[model samples]
Target: MIRVVILGAGNIAQHLYTVFTKSEAIQVVQVYNRSQKALQSFTNVATTTRLKELRDADVYIIAVADDAIASVANKLPFTNRLVVHTSGSASMHVLHKKNRRGVFYPLQTFTKGKEVDFSQIPLCLEAREKTDFKVLQQLADAIGSPSYKISSEQRRALHVSAVFVNNFSNHLYRIAHEICEANNVPFQILHPLIQETAHKITTLTPYMAQTGPAKRGDQKTIDDHLEKLDKDIHKEIYTLLTQSIAKTYGREKL
Candidate 1:
């Protein structure tokens, strides 16, 4: 079995620990955190507050915040071992040069209490050595996740695109929620449209799936939307997105 020591007790770390423990091909030997309190949730595995006391493992997975990853890696007692971090934007080179470095980024937004299906989540991996890449691929396979060998530059681009698709899209949903609230309409009314939009993208390219006034260059409808928006920020967002959509369809004059 592939032995792993997970460092950090945050959402991603907790989720990885849970999934790894369930896989017969992998074993989470220990979990480390800066404090013992965060380590309490990892009931089945060994836990440690002291980095120097970390046991030897085949791979050390640092699932901490992007900023803290380097600090944790630099403090590790040993060197030249396989070490990987779970970050999309942070380059694998951010890990101190003392160890064999790699990335094991899961391309999905993780929530603390929500369970994620590993099979559907994409695992983006990178390694300095080919053998280390295989190890990460094996770990991804053990967790039933699809794996991709991506360079740091490519991963950074993907991270930015992910922000546009996932984070920005979620914020739009929040804005819709606020609009519904102001109008005294149940936000649930938009649930089917939301689901349909997500479902459409699976079968059709986003450009092909695009619809509505902006795509059609319906200036009257666009103006109506901007005028109806109660907040200036909302109006600005509407105008900017509409202009973007219009530009995408070669209707810049609209």
Candidate 2:
């Protein structure tokens, strides 16, 4: 069995602890945080606020904030054990050199109280040693996740792409919601389009799936959209995205 200790109590940490405990091949020996209050969510397992009190486990998984990862790793009482962090952007080398470092980045947005299917989430793994990489892979498999061996450089690129696809896209949805609210239209009207757009990318490349007035070089429709927008920020965003789409399809003159 792969014994593990999670080193945070945030959304990602809680999700990981829940899934790890469910897997027969893995065991969550303990969970550590800066305080005992957050640790309360982790029931029936060992919990501690002291780094020196950490138990011996096959791996120590740091699921803390990106900035705090190094600080937590530096405080670990022992060295040379497998230490991994669940961060997409932070480099594995950020963990103190006192221990073997690896990354176990789950490439998905996690939210508190929302249950996720671990089988569909991509687990990006990186390590200096092949053996260490294998250990991460085993952990990923135990949780029914597909694991990818990615370098720190490649993981950084993935992180940026994730921001574009997930964060930026969500912000666009928020903008659309605001627009709908301002115009007295039900935001639910856009739900089908949103679902269809997401579903299309499954079988079609985003470039091929692209369809809109901007893609068709319909300047009149694009102009109508900009004119209908009430907020200057909304208009500006519309204009910028229209220009971007036009440029992508080689219709920059539009």
Candidate 3:
């Protein structure tokens, strides 16, 4: 079995732990978190709050916040072992040089209490050594995840793109919900459109899938939207997005 130590109890950590446990080829030997309450769900495995008490394992996966990764890795009491992080943005170099460094970033947004199919999530792997990379790939394979060998630079670029698609897009959804609420309309009305738009990208490039008043350079429709928005911030956002879309479709003058 590929012994693994997960060093966090957050959303990604919990999800990973659950999936790893279901894989016979991978064993989550230990789960460490500074907060005892956070480690409560990981009752079946060995748990510790102290870095000095970490157990020997084939790999140590730091599933903590991006900012806290280096500090945690620097504090690890062991050295010359495979250490990896589950951060999409942070580089593998963030880990202390004391241990073999790698990145095991799963390019998907994880939420507590939400069960996601690990096999469908793309696993971005990076390691300083070839052997360490193989170990990460084996772990990914054990979990039935599609693994990709990516460099730190490529991973950084991918992370920025993720924010645009996932984070920024979610914020737009919230804005739409707010607009619907203000108009006394059900937010669920847009659910089908949202799903259709999401599925369209799977078969068509986003540029080709584009369709909207802005794409058609309908300034009157754009102005109506801006005027209908009650909040200045919402109007500003609408104008900015309209401009972006118009420029994308060669309707920049609109």
Q: TM-score of predicted model 2?
A: 0.98
For residues 8-67, write the lDDT of model 2, one tens digit per residue: 999999999999999999999999999889988889899999999999999999999999
The CA lDDT at 21 in model 2 is 91
Model 1 Cα RMSD, 1 decimal: 0.7
In angstroms, how far off is 127's CA in candidate 1? 0.6
Local accuracy by lDDT, each model: 0.95, 0.94, 0.94
Over 4 Å off, model 2? none
List candidate 3 stretches off by more than 4 Å. none
Best by lDDT: 1
RMSD values for the candidates in order, in angstroms, are 0.7, 0.8, 0.8
Q: In model 3, where is the ten-residue run with the lowest total lDDT? A: 219-228
Kindly give the number of clashing pairs for every candidate: 0, 0, 0
In candidate 2, which residue pairs get closer than 3 Å at backbone N, Cα or C atoms, i.e. clash? none
Q: Residue 131 deviation, candidate 1, in Å?
A: 1.0
Ranking by lDDT: 1, 2, 3
